[model samples]
Each structure stands twice: as structure tokens, then as C-alpha cells.
Target: MSNLIPTGRTDIEWRNESTQKPPKAAVYPAEANADKILKAAYEHTATVWTGDFHNAKQVLAAMKKRVKRPSEKKRAGGGDAVAERSRNIQTAFHAHRMKQAQQSRILNMLAVEIGAGFTLDIPRAPDVKAALADVYGKPNDAPFLLPLNQLLGFIGAHEWHKKGVEIPALGGRIHVPFGVFSPLRGEYLDLIAAALAGSKFQTAFDIGTGSGIIAALLAKHGVPKITATDTNPRAVACACANFCRLDLDNIVIEKTDLFPAGCADLIVCNPPWLPAKPSSAVEAALYDPESRMLEGFLNGAAAHLNDGGEVWLVMSDLAEHLHLREQDFLPQCFQTASLEIAEVLQTRPKHAKAADENDPLAFARGREVTSLYRLKKAV
Candidate 1:
């Protein structure tokens, strides 16, 4: 058992004996312990959790089953009480985090089995050791170990990279690279296309441009100039790659948290629809938790809009229908931000999850609604 403590924040560098490739490893947090590391490895491997990788994944998914279990049991039946339900949800969230943290710790404690080749003893190790090596910039013979949680994260990210979703709305489909968000919802894309049909803006800014889909759409619609900005390095890389592929290299992709230091005739944002704590880094698309992105866009939008410029706010009232958020509070947020609603375009979600009767929030889905609001900064 070799314990290598990182000196500081600097990455750990290693050389592969066979492939002569160099790779850098991330430093683990100081407080990680052996038990936490072991738990993470067990979670990743199907043997301890089960023997099948898919089964292990299903077990992990079971953690979220309660989040949508309310609709299955009739209102007056032997279902959990409201208070119990809330507590269960809270527990689910905490357990999810605990599992993730343990996984990260395990990856940090991982030790490499070095010989003529390399292998990892971590539980349920991914079959894509070659792919992982490529990403880590190492050869198959490089002897290195990463935290169990981090290794799982890398493998999950690799899968997502391999099976990229294509957006039909954007003529040139955007690919989701590792650690970048994939556009999983299609209803919102339809809403955006319809909303942009009658609008005329030569220059536009796409705030929080995850995969740069909006920017690509603007460019496709004959908009000569579009600026796409995101704070995440993964998002920036994904967006740039999509733009380059579409030959919209003119669409500048910036690494800004929000708006750039200039104004635009049109600014558009599709902030996460729900305001709740995210279960993981990947859940940013589903939950903003703090409404930080939504608020930031609204508060800074007025300053970035040109004369008669419009800020397109695409969102859903699903949270409101589920009682998680107040429907009327959205307009109030606009008012507080000093903006007025110019127009509202509504659409229904096409995802099967929306109409899933078994979902805990299905009551809302039965009558759920989503909309796109065009707002203008008050003069």
C-alpha cells in the first residue's frame, strides 16, 4: 500500500514505459480516508454491488427511484406521508452525494499494477482502459493510479463522449465532449426555433452556451455574428469544436461566466428550469439549485441589450406545477430585474419523462407547461 501525498495543487506527472506517453493526475482533497476510498471502488465494481456493470448502474439509479414514486401509490393508500416523503427525498440527495464522494476518495487511493503492461484492481474497472490512457496522455504500459471516484467519472465521461447526441434543430449537430453538457431536452429547441423565426438580430450573444447550439442556430439563421460564452473549460471546447465543424468559426466562443464586455442586439439564455440543489456536476442542466444563472442573466441582460434589443428567456413552469416554484414569481423576478415581458411563446415537452405517470411529480405533468419569454429592458 503506497500512500503518495500531493505537495500542493500541482498535477502529478508520470511517464509510460512502453508508449512513452506523459500524463498528469489530479490531486485529491486532503481529508480523504481509506474507508471512503474503498466504498467508492465497491460502488463502481459490480462484484460487491453485483457482478454486472449494468446492474451496478441500476442500483445507483435506484437511489433516484423515490424522487418519482409519489404517483404510483394512490393518494389515500399506504404511501409515505408528506413529511416522510420530503425526508426521504432529502435522504436520497444526501446518499447520492455520499456515494459520489466515496467514489472520488477511492479513485484517489487507487494503486497501479505495473508490469510489462498495466491494469487497475479497482472494482468494476471500465473496459476502456485504452481510451482512458488516451485521455490521460499515457501509454498502455504507464503505471499510474487515480482515485476510484475520479476513474469512474472519467469512464462515464468517456461513454458520453462516444455516444454524442445530435440536435436536428441546429443544421450542424453539436457533439458533447467529455465533461461538457449534452442537450437532452428537445422541446426547448423547438421553442427556440419558433421564437427566432420572426425576430431579426444580426448580432447575438448566447449566454451560458453549453454546447454552443444556440450560437450555431443563430448563425444558421443568417445571423452574421454570434458570441457564445461559458465559464467551463469543457463547454468552451465543445462549443468551439461544434462551431468549427459547422464552418461557423466566426462565432466566437469565450470563457466568460456570463455576458462578455460588450452589448448585442439579441441576447438569449436557457437557464436550468428547476431551482434546486444538483445531485452532481452533470446535473447542472436539470437543477440550478440557487437560480444563480437565471438571476445573473436577468440582472445583467438590460445592460447588454442594444436599443430595442430583446433578451430571450427560455424556461419551463414544470417546477411551478409541482409546487416547487411559484409560477407568478417568474414575472416578479423580471420586474425586480427591471425588464418587461415583450412576448411569450409556449411549448410542450417531447421527452417521455414528462408524461411518465409513475413520476412523483406526475400530477404536475398531467397539466404541465413550458414557455419561452422575450423580455426587453425598460428604457
Candidate 2:
């Protein structure tokens, strides 16, 4: 939603309802009234304000103000709610700009494929740029020509990811990159963590570690040595950063197709089970064309696993529910890879999307079963 509110184009207006027209009070270059405007927003007051991207300093200042509360507890409690409301305001106020930003990203990536330079840099005000610059030790150079959509996405992630995601399963919060693929980190990550709870491996491999979440979990569970790999450079950089931030020096992240050279006592892969083409980099972790990643792990795993070691395959059966893949597809691949399943730990998805009747694949998502299949070399 960072792209939701692009600088300039004062045409953006926020009301309790989307259909509401721009108010006359919303005039560009208007005086900065951060206190009043923020007070009104907190009171659920509807006052449209229009300011060209040039005057975004005034606009963003008003938006960032704390929605004042009377009691100290209420003021301090649920800061997340306040942040959520701010995001809602941003999302609802400039929905069209976000779409435009996304379209720009898609076009940019496609253009880059055919030898186009990334020439688009979303214009940011001094305050906005400074806010982004605040997060350093990672990078603090002048802004480069990042794609409008992706840069905005990064900005949004910088703001929220700074808060970090609490994973009760791991007894910690995982800070992820702006646009990196984050496995919902609950059911799947926790399931795999739980399945390997009592086990202690001298060395472990986390295949396609997007955010290094799984590898970190394995490390926390007493894995002495862990090597993680990812095909995407962004994921590689992201996982590495998260590892440093989380003090998980024990986990080594590398940029590789699936697995690095040599072998380990445990090999873990959480492939995109569905067989389809990914529309974006973000979707790559969800859609595995012809199940290439999945198959790659199954086929290459045995060569890297130590004797009696197992490959942990974490995935969901939503593909079968949607008729995109057969129920026996995974097992068949295992057998084809000359691997035998040692144990199957399954859990039903409890996400809100599963209960949504409007989801096209509600029937499938509702009944989806995620499993961690422990596979070992067949005799």
C-alpha cells in the first residue's frame, strides 16, 4: 500500500466512503494544519485535503500524526491499530495511484527482460526520502532509479516491517524485506518447526529460503550448522539481512538455484506446490510452473542428504482441491525420485481467506491441507 499514496497529483482525496466527491476544503498549497487535520481524522472527521506532490510535506505530516487518546493505556496500547488506520487512510485515499504503480512495475520488469534500463524513479519529497533514509547500516546512499511500484512497495515495507511480524511458533518476530516472498510464517513455518522439534541435526539445508524464516527456526531448534539457498537475488539479500538482524550467524545464506554443493544431515524445501506461471516476482514463491522447484528438490535432495537423513517437504494440497494438480502428484514425484515417505504431518489452514466465500478458490482454500512430508532415500 506504499504505492497507494504517490506524491503529487493532488487529485487524491479521502472520505469515509469512496463515492464521496472531493471537498472544496481540499485545496492544494493550503496551509499546513497537521494538528487539526490529524484530530479530525482521529475523530472520524471527513475533510478532504488536496495538495500537489510538491506540497506533500504538509500532507504527509498531517497523515503521520498520532491519533490522540485520552487514557495513557489507550494511547500506548495497540499502536498497531493506529498504524493500521493510517494504512487504511493511505489505501482508501489513493487507490488508483496504487494500480498505476503496479502496472508500472509489471511494465518495467517486462521491459527489463528485453534490455530496457530501469529509468523510472518515483519522486519523493525531502521528508519522505529522509524517512526512508532513517533505516541505515543496510544502505543510505542517494536514491537510485528504482521502479515506481517496487520502490513504493519497499517504502511501505520499510515502514511496517520495521515493526516486525510476531511468530508465536518461533517465540520471536521476523523482520522481512520489502518485497521478498514471506511464507505466511504461521501454519507452514510452525508446522515444519514443530515436526522437527525434538530432532537435532549436525547440518541442515533450507532450500529456497525466501526470508530465512525456516532456516532460522531450524537454527533455534538446535541445528548446529544450517545452509540456506534461494534462486532470487532479492531473496538472497533479504534472507542474509534478516539473519544478521536476528543474530542467526549460525545460518549461512547463499544465492543458488536450490541447494549448495555438498550434503547435510537434513534437507528442507517449501516449494510452491501449485503448477502455474508466476505473474510477478512476488508470485514466484506461490506459483511453480510445472512444479519445477518441487521436482528439483525431490530429485536433487537424495544426493545431498546424509544416510538416514530426510528431506522435509512443506506444502499444501490446494492444487488438488482446485483441480490444478492430482492428489497423488506429490507422492508420485517422491516415488519417481526414489524416495520414501517416513512421516506426514498435516495441518488445516486457518487463515481468514479460507473462510471468505468470495474467494474464487474458497472451496479449495477452505479444505486445503498443508503437510510436512518427511522423505528419505528409498531402498
Write model 2 residue lDDT over 274-300, tens digit each, in one string: 777655566788879888888888999
The Cα local distance difference test for each model comes to: 0.63, 0.62
Model 1 per-residue lDDT tens digits across residues 189-232? 87888777876787899998988888888888877888999987
- What TM-score would each prediction reach against the true structure? 0.69, 0.65
Check candidate 2 and list the clashing pairs. Answer: 8-53
- Residue 339 shift from truth in candidate 2, angstroms: 0.7
Most lDDT-accurate candidate: 1
Clashes of each: 13, 1
Regions of model 2 farther than 4 Å from truth? 1-126, 130-152
